[model samples]
Target: MITRRMLLGTMVAAPAAACAHSLTEPEYPRVGAVERLDPRLDAIIAPDAPIEVLATGYSWAEGPTWVDRGGYLLFSDPPNNVVHRWQPGVGAAPFLKPSGLAGPIPAAVREAGANGLDIDRQGRLVMADSGTRAIARVDLATKQKTLLATRYQGKRFNSPNDLVISRTGAIYFSDPPYGFSAFDESPLRELLFNGVYRLAPDGSVALLDDSHHRPNGIGLSPDERTLYLALSDEKRPQVLAYSLDAYGMPTGAPRLFLDMSEGLAAGRPGLPDGLKVDSAGHVFATGPGGVHICTPEGDLLGIVATGKAVANCALGGPNGRDLFLTSHDMLARVRLSRPA
Candidate 1:
């Protein structure tokens, strides 16, 4: 277990992108200094450790994924409908342009912005395609496009936001009615209540639960025994946790493991949209202020100190010890003793 003080011993605690931390203050920066959730966690992160801001740019940044092979980060610029690639040495550049939408002309552009990204076991670029209203993949090597999933029953999905790929090639994603609803835009009636779903290795799509109000971000614990889903549109939003079966399918009613509205006074409205887990069951959720570190029990253990309403984050760097964060018009980073 890592404690706050121990993390601070080796790290300097400061905001990398301090100016864009949030629209409002989160608890007015307490005078006694930030406290960690418990002493046991001090072994991992020190409370006063510095949070380094790596990059800052973009208009409403959404999904963030680590491209390990490229040794950098690839994330979304939603309103711009594009994806960017950022590396420490070269800085950020255009990674995927017009990432999704297609028009009459092959060069025609239509809102191709990407939402979330992940690499499959086979090394394919699996993406939560918001503009196309589907979960698609692009071969990281050949750059070939393959549609993984688009519809649940007979209706098309509203928009696929975030996804994770298991070792077995099984892909899981969260579909919420956020995008323009290109799939089924007829009367604007949502047939299925925004759900957390799974796409098996066989290419079959299964609805794990339609209960999630608006599943925004989705990730699995290192052990695969627990599944975490972020309800972005939740009133007084929260990150929910569920017990999963051996097959990696959820088996029970999802419950709130953590309520995100506690520390935030003025910040982003949604809970989280992108999340990543460490070797342990601990989860890092992008919240209104920054990347929130939570225990398996859902306790708010510490923060990465992005000083911004971090929209998404991923574990990367030389050994995955560096944390990359995202937000509206900002991209930041922090180093961690633990790997992403």
Candidate 2:
């Protein structure tokens, strides 16, 4: 077993430009910096904490999920069509190959892999399979995959980008054409609109909303009463909060939670994408510059700037105090004062 501390020791001894398929060496001892915007931010993240680079050399790292039972962190590399597993004592290694597209795919297709990942209550690995254009579950023991939802109103989904499981066993996800070679213009696209959907426990699919141009990430509140959807569209990059009814369906009009138009105007690196909510209701959403920490009431707390285009984040570790971040080609970790 190779622990992070041991990896750090090896990193110091290796050449700075060493490029390995598994863990790429970092040029700097630490890759990025963190910013403390408000005093309240101190409650969650320590003021003097450093952001540690865990691994690198991924084509496009996204969809980080912590498996507490296995004591490992799993993340997706969409372009490579694989999922990598990172354990404190085991370093980083490929856990799944052909993660999304299992059958013959067109030659023009570029991205054919999974994106967002979550552990269901049954301890199964649930994934937003972009290549297959569906939500799937994988059995850890046998590596068998079961397609849970693939279509809405008889039309196949463009691509399932991100997903979150509610307390009631309901699955909420976003479908954008990101998997297509030309996005919406791709000839393989089936759905006319990008949608956010809910999959009931009984295997029923319902379209929550299709108004957003590009819905990339989806998360549920601690109480499962509010759903937060991140719009990756540059024209209207924002996070929208929708109130849920008793049956876990959206009710009334959705409200703007946080708008990143100013950040876009200032030329930040990323758009609104993957997000997660803490036990106290603070939303750590991947947005312009880094992960935006905001209150449930929509107050901007601070930003965890990775100095790169961060795609997604997950709370993990024994106490859930470790924040695993998936940036452009790098995977990083930061210990938080507050646990999720």
Candidate 3:
């Protein structure tokens, strides 16, 4: 029952107050200062949600997912190849190191694949692995991993970038050519186009779609009837939406969900990567300058003004009111008006 508005009543800090000028102040006139990086996003959320700095100082954080059980937020710092945990009152902690590989693998090559993560319907931690090109399970008790999927059409996936477990345990993930071996004699391997895939409970891998140039972020609609994904490749950069059938299978033609490159502050350093949704359906997506707020209808509400090309985010803290974020080299948080 914790909502974002309730958490903000206690005051939230902007991600970087040093570079952000609060519009709440009268002297700071709107003077086109509020940039909606994606032109299509201009109508997504709302322009008034005040942003505040939360936490900071990390290195290239990605893959943020919430763990309501532990009352903390978790995200991956890829360059460091580790997962970090954060709670509102107690601060951040080293939740897990050398996050396990999905399939049978050697210890030396295991840690390299840990990347995207999610909480399965069973309340267990699940993740996508670039190091191993597979999706895996993390037993809350022993932290043992059970491989879910890693191959399709007799070929290994390039990398499992991001994933989501449906209410029924169905697994969907994005595959890109970012996890292959570089003649390093590493055990990691990859194949196939940078695609979006689905893993059935029986370990069957389905190529959901391949239209994306390089899909980096993926999420389901609040109603579970649509698939929203981000294409990191500037050639086809966009937040695309796909219609789904009753079984949650994606069908029909995909459409431009949000062409961020045409947005207010389009020319920035980063591309869309990781994203999360709230119970009420608002999407907090990573953008060049910070987090971009979007309405369920794919309209842009506004930006959170993190002052960094935020990599990803998740809802945690007491009641999911805390917005945990990972910028290029920093981890931070803030109170929002919506809970995830």
Best by TM-score: 2
TM-score of candidate 3 to 2 decimals: 0.78
Q: Spell out the clash pairs found in candidate 2.
A: 2-89
- Per-residue lDDT tens digits of candidate 2, residues 1-340? 3211111111111232122223433443466667888889888987577888889899889999987666678899987899898866457899889899977777646579999999988777899999988999998667789999988988888879899999888999999888887777878877889999999999999988888888988898989999999988777889999999999998987999999888867877788889999999899998888889898998887888888778899987656798888988899988899787
lDDT of each: 0.67, 0.83, 0.64
Quality of model 1 by C-alpha lDDT: 0.67
What's the residue-level lDDT of 180 in candidate 3?
43
Clashes of each: 19, 1, 23
lDDT of 3 by residue, 153-185 (tens): 877776678887777778888876545433123
Q: For model 1, how does the per-residue alpha-carbon lDDT over 1-340 read when each residue is reduced to its tens digit?
A: 2211111110112242222222232221111122466765565566765555445567667677776555557788865777787666456777676777654312222235668888766556889887777889987545567887878887777667788887778888987765642323424434657777889988899989887666778888887778888776535467888888989877778878777776444543335567888877788886655567888788777765544456778876646677666755666665565664
TM-score on alpha carbons, each prediction: 0.81, 0.91, 0.78
Worst 10-residue lDDT window for candidate 1 reads 3-12
Find the 10 residues in a row with the least total lDDT in model 3: 3-12
**Residue 317 C-alpha lDDT in model 2:** 69
Misplaced by over 4 Å in model 3 are 1-57, 100-113, 181-190, 263-266
